[model samples]
Target chain A: MTTPTPSSPSGPSRLDPEPTPRRDFLGLASLWAAASTMLFAAIGMMRLPKAAVLSSPSKKYLVQLPDSLAPGEAFEPPGRAVVLFRDEDGVYAMSKVCTHLGCLIKKNGDGFDCPCHGSRFGIDGSVVKGPAPQPLAWHKVTRVGEAYMVDEGVAVPTGAKEQA
Target chain B: MSDSPIKTSQSALGRFWRNLAGAPRAVWRAAFRSGAPTTDRTRSQFVFNNIFLHIHAVRTHRWSLRWTTTMGLGIAAAAAFLITVVTGILLMFYYKPYPEAAYDSVKDIHFVVPTGRFIRNLHRWAANVMVVTVILHMARAFYTAAYRRPREFNWLIGLGLFAVTLGLSFTGYLLPWDQLAYWAITIGANIAQSPREVTDALGITAYFDPGGFQRQLLLGSDVVGEEALIRFYLLHVMILPLALSTLLAVHIWRVRKDGGLTRPADADRRLGPPPGDVYPVFTDAPMKTYHLAAVVRGRSPAVGKGPENTVPSMPHLFYAELAALMVTVLVCLALAITWHAPLKEIANPDVPENPAKAPWYFLGLQELVSYSAFMGGVGLPAIVLLGLGLIPFLDREQEGTGEWFGGPGGKGLVARSAIFGLAVVLLVETVAIGFGWIREWYPEAPQLLITLLNPGTLIAAAYALYSMWLVHRYDSVRSGAMGLFTCFLCGFIVLTIIGTYFRGPNWTFYWSMADWPKH
Candidate 1:
């Protein structure tokens, strides 16, 4: 055999540079698989909801009342709106929207009191408290040819008086 | 040639005088050898030829000098660490790591041993200064972008160093075993164990339950007591220091590898040819001819010799670092002599502490814990910290622009917008937290309004979110400015009105015994 020449001024000549070690390949493969699995798992976890759902039955009630109630009289309905009248027998359904801030008013004794700001409204929807400047809003109840249907469409201002 | 013989002799004499005064013949002989190819000997010759001697015999940047800053800081910190080791050894002579002896040992340090207080204070102040200096150095590196490119790995190492610093501080904090250290560390560890609130917000839980086993492993028992003191003592003295020193060496090595301090261009050029090239050799034979020409012009060849340039970590840097070390040592000594670290009454494991506060750095988080158990306890803070740590990984661009967001070069508009939004949210939350109790006391007018604003804190948070969105969409700068102003104002209001004025004995529970039945 011909004399093998040295690659450089350094020691030793390699014969067919040693094949890649099997352990290195196995180690690299395992690392790759582990990393991929962790990444996928993290992404999957992000889609879950953070808050618990509330379970209460009282939130679903609806309100129903006669077309119109007389002024100075009030209607406390379970579902939709609490009504307060401004004058006797002359019907008016006052929406319970509290004038103090916009919280629904609860009827106390002779008038309506706002729980949020403590604003009080008289039987006729007049402002009785210092915090609330304006009276409670009165809903329009038109007599459509004696059928006694209350018009829930229009809101009548508390200051406006209907002509007979 | 024959007519100028007298002139040539005079020139030769003048040249000899010049070489003697400045560039000595011996220096030339050391620089270049006769009958050798210049290229073959260029590298070695360069080192000896230059008057401004450097180890590498090449030019480099001046900002590279700040690497010296890091090194100097580390050395100073190490000196403090050494002091701590010596003092700790001394204390161990009399001190016991058991709970029974820990407090007694502290008392001995204060009242019993001669100059024991001095040793203890020296350790404490050195630690405090080390932490502060490390932070400042980090900030300097961050602003200068010294952490960019090849240096990123070192930055990570630095982060590890920072962690070690914190660990050392924490473990040392408990050595005193008094009320302040005990409660503060207890709260601090609790905070660490609690899931970060931000992470919870993101609905992510890498939940690994740390049972009593883990606690025992960490504290050497279920609670912070004698076992904990011993464990902390070991960690502070032995484990962390070893880890820190090992990492510090690696950190310095990486800096050397990356390239010495980044300097202004002019300063860099003044050093010599750029790094890697050998400077030209000045041989005695050539020197004699050059000197003759210089003598003919009646000028000294070495008159314009510039200031010496050096590679970082070389002799020049070594001296500067020593100077910095001296200053640091004197400061540590002064602090050790005058001040005593805070140590409260002995801890009673049976009594629960009221309104338990965390360490100062964790006050923001502790305040957060007061919000909601789910949000404050687990969600928000975790996300914030994780996100902060992940910033470097997320912004991986190659550009050197100093914008806070995105990979290096892109405009930081998105990042700025995000920061602004976050600022707004924080401001709003502060206000909400501050005024929540007041609003709770004064219910809104209508029942509906009360329902809407009953959790006034939530309303404030919602408002803050909305404001952030607004800033993101339109007024970015204004958003940040307003958000900061609002947070400040709210903080002031809370501190003055709510915290100082309204928080009474009922609110400010000093010890759990205040509320506990005295039977």
Candidate 2:
């Protein structure tokens, strides 16, 4: 217990001029504990959305290329995110998902055109026109027996092809 | 137990009749804790004691009850919301929140369940009505300058409620899982992902994109599917409603604390004293002590500003509220009966709707998005909302506080602003649609340049410059705010109308839907 002094005219209280050192330490400790608790809780919440197991279909699928498909033609598998192209060199896969906003692009006469925004990708997946910053991504392709397996989850370098 | 000694004079039958005669009064007293309110004291007590009526002030200004004052828009909006809640609950009992079954469930509700169709229609119409009424209510508050002084926080709360209302509507729009719902939500989701435009242009989207995160969180996946349906349903049925109700409680409480609905500061002087004034003693005090709920360090201006020209809220204000509510319900009922809510073909992602549009309210935003994805959808709306939030603080002039268009000179200013705003919006839209923009002439233009120089940005810039000129000319912040707000409001209306009616396939301009080429 301290008596009121000339310097501290209002009251002889621990909080008058400033909190006592012990009180300040305790307050700081409590604040840190509360903040860390909130941070951990937020981190815990972030883990919930990334499920270990997904019920949806896998992104990697094997596509049987139509025998009649010409060397320079593009064949898009129904309901899949990848479009397969077989040329004289080999079979390659390009992502149907637009580089701009992820709208699946439709195959035009010479290239691909995005329906959402008017971004156009050429036959080789290079951006002919854009709001699309980069060209369409190329997906990893491997020959699984006669059918080609395109892995949408893995991006391969542009023009990388599975040898025919 | 036998009653014999005290009832010697009365027969058994007479005693029973006497007991029955007093039963009604006993029940009434038990329920109300008071007699019928024939006097001002009882009426005040009736309002103060009742839980349902307690949100209202015990005494309401007579001016507040006028048809022109608030136009009962707030009450109507609340009533419409109530209707939506009741009907929405009924809908939840039968409606499934799964992607596979949602459309089927809606179809069953339409064709099978007892009065489900009517309830669903009512819910749809009521939600629409709530949106319209809420917007009109906001417009009313703005035009009358009711968002001034102590009521600014309440205005912000009201704005929050407005946002929650739209959130509720947008979430509900997806529950049907039809083509209309699917495509509309897709367009909306894309708009939510508009920040990718900026990120993409800057070549940082691969590492960082808040817009993409928002869209993913909203949809619960990359697209509107099983996860999106459940997420939207949860938000629509539970989270948003909870938020809205809580905000509404605060909004109404703030209204009470702000000393009821605002009127001109000199309203009492103009109207003289109210007729049949019984509380002369309460009103006549030079320094009303009842208002001093707390001790003050200085001379407070609120010392003598007691309530004026007021009537008991029980019969006067409550009656008006009830009337407004009834009118709203009747109108909704009429609309529900006359027109059925639309249900389109089941959602097909592969075969997309050619001119896929968002809900009517978001059409204005969608129209903007057609010009430039990021600026139109994200930037412009953000700026508008920020501007709206800052208005009360910026225009601190409290002179024409509670009058329509801020009184005489204000009316002329607003009119001029509206016309100017309309002209600017139309001109910009026409030029953008007819002649094309920067992207058309400079095909190789940078995405950032095109994004920054779209029709939406042009209109916004024009409006800003015009409002600043008005401010400089009038030498008043309030007038400037008024001009800007009116211009934006006009632009919003014009854009919405065009988006809803004039635009067609591929978002191309059309005079009418009749002119749209058949697929």
Candidate 3:
């Protein structure tokens, strides 16, 4: 056994400093792994919602149309243009939207008047007033047996015949 | 030698079978670097050679493995952390960190992705479990006196790990971007903002304010917005986990250096004598005398105590941990599959969640803030932490190191302290009701000073004074510390329960949880 010298510090003792620092390579490697992961995540985040798929809007509307538009009668569906006109042959569908500015037209004497831009249309959607450039566009109406199925996506000319 | 064709073919097939079964012996030796431990020498070598098993000691104390000693809280915490990391990584694939898209992306995750909801729920619940079990781990360490002497530094590291665990939870709370997530984080951020309250009350914030410093540092703007979202995401994903992993490595290493846990004095004697070759004697002198003379740090030779009352980490601890991991993962998965995580309407800043809670844990602090911001947010929390940090330094008695509440008389002392602690907590809570006259006298005083002179702080100081007297009376600060720690825990639990259930809109008091509105 070696006796301790007060002045000498060297030893074959188990009093040497730890191997703890030597194991720090594990920690450093873990951190580097974390840094690289963050970089990859950053790169991933750079790719935006560019490939997001938006669903297209449906083009069909189910509208109930009675046999005829008698006097003081109308078909004003909520959120849809009201179609009201009394014809000798049958009931004719007229758009309540003014062609002048696309504002909803209210019922008037023998026709409709635009609340927004002061444009008027005859009962058959013919322009009977100024500031109205063309007649109201017609939504092609198809008879689905009992009620009318309007092709709202396809708007046709007013005087043209409505499809069955 | 006229051999039949069928017999000759069978001989060739036998050769193929022998080669298939016997091949890769060289490769297996190269990979393992050792044969299976049929002997003691090989068992030690097998453990030391493997990268994964090297962290665990070849042999461990029976007490350390016993259910009551640790209750497997620390292992559970570690296992929960593993779950969080795995589930969190999977979640990162689906989560987008933008205000407008964050909520929708989460919605898409719920409605579109398969098993995505389960992953997210498991991540959340695992985080909560991690936090709770970590606190329980700390309590176990304290009660067992594992933080005594050489293990004190490890205590500080453990404290850091606890804080980081909470930080992990806080950062994750904001990711979902629902009204609940938004306002919950807002309440937390607003709590962070309370540092300015003291500074502003003092009128010196123009020069420097650390509270405002933390606020601006965290939030790029006045409120929780795009920058806050990104910062929280980065912290949750990378910065905190990296810190936790490093600290955990150090903590485990230090545990070995500190002489495995501070088990009972005769734990090794109970296991009979140490095995001869397994744990070869390392030093000529006593470890105690050597350590005092010269601070030497390395792996303790006491690790290989013997296998009678100890077992190999290879199969024993590893299998136990695996069982814990399996149970935790299954429970979290079951919870995830059965109940979905909360995702209220797309975070509309226009519509606020009234009486917006700051998660259940922080609701205690929030409730305190209702009484006083400085005391609740900063002062009281500081006191609790300082008290905990000062424990080892204050209680210098090592006589009762490995026992609960300190020594043989611990049960009696703790029971007395528990009674004292509960009474103190009750007195602090209800003192204001009795002291209505003080409020009447100070009707026109500044609210800050009114909060400064709150009854909770005074009653607590009085309790400390009384406990200090008892410490002198019994000649033991350990008893005092026990009383204070137990009191703080009771107060925290009570306040959290009250804040979570009984507190209503506008911070009004209600009789029970049912009294609160359905919303």
* Top candidate when judged by lDDT against the true structure: 2
Query: What is the per-residue lDDT of model 1 for residues B187-224, given as tens digits with 9 covering 90 to 100?
Result: 44444443322233233434544422233355654346
**Candidate 3 lDDT over residue span B207-320, tens digit each:** 868866566556655457787788788888999999999998888778767856667766667556545533432344434444323344434544333235565665666677
- The C-alpha stretches of model 2 lying farther than 4 A from their native spots are A1-56, A71-74, A85-94, A98-137, A156-164, B1-28, B277-306
Q: List the lowest-lDDT window of 10 residues for candidate 2 chain B.
A: B291-300
The backbone clash count of each candidate, in order, is 32, 0, 0
TM-scores of the candidates are 0.49, 0.87, 0.67
Higher-ranked by TM-score: 1 or 3: 3
User: For this target, which candidate reaches the highest DockQ against the unseen true structure?
Assistant: 2
Could you give the DockQ of candidate 1? 0.01
Task: Provide the lowest-lDDT 10-residue window in model 3 chain B.
Answer: B277-286
Candidate 3: residue pairs that collide: none
Off by over 4 Å in 3: A1-164, B1-28, B269-310, B431-443, B459-463, B517-519
* Model 2 interface RMSD over true interface Cα atoms: 3.5
**On residues B216-275, what C-alpha lDDT tens digit does candidate 2 reach at each position?**
777777667898888889999999999999998888878878878888877778777678
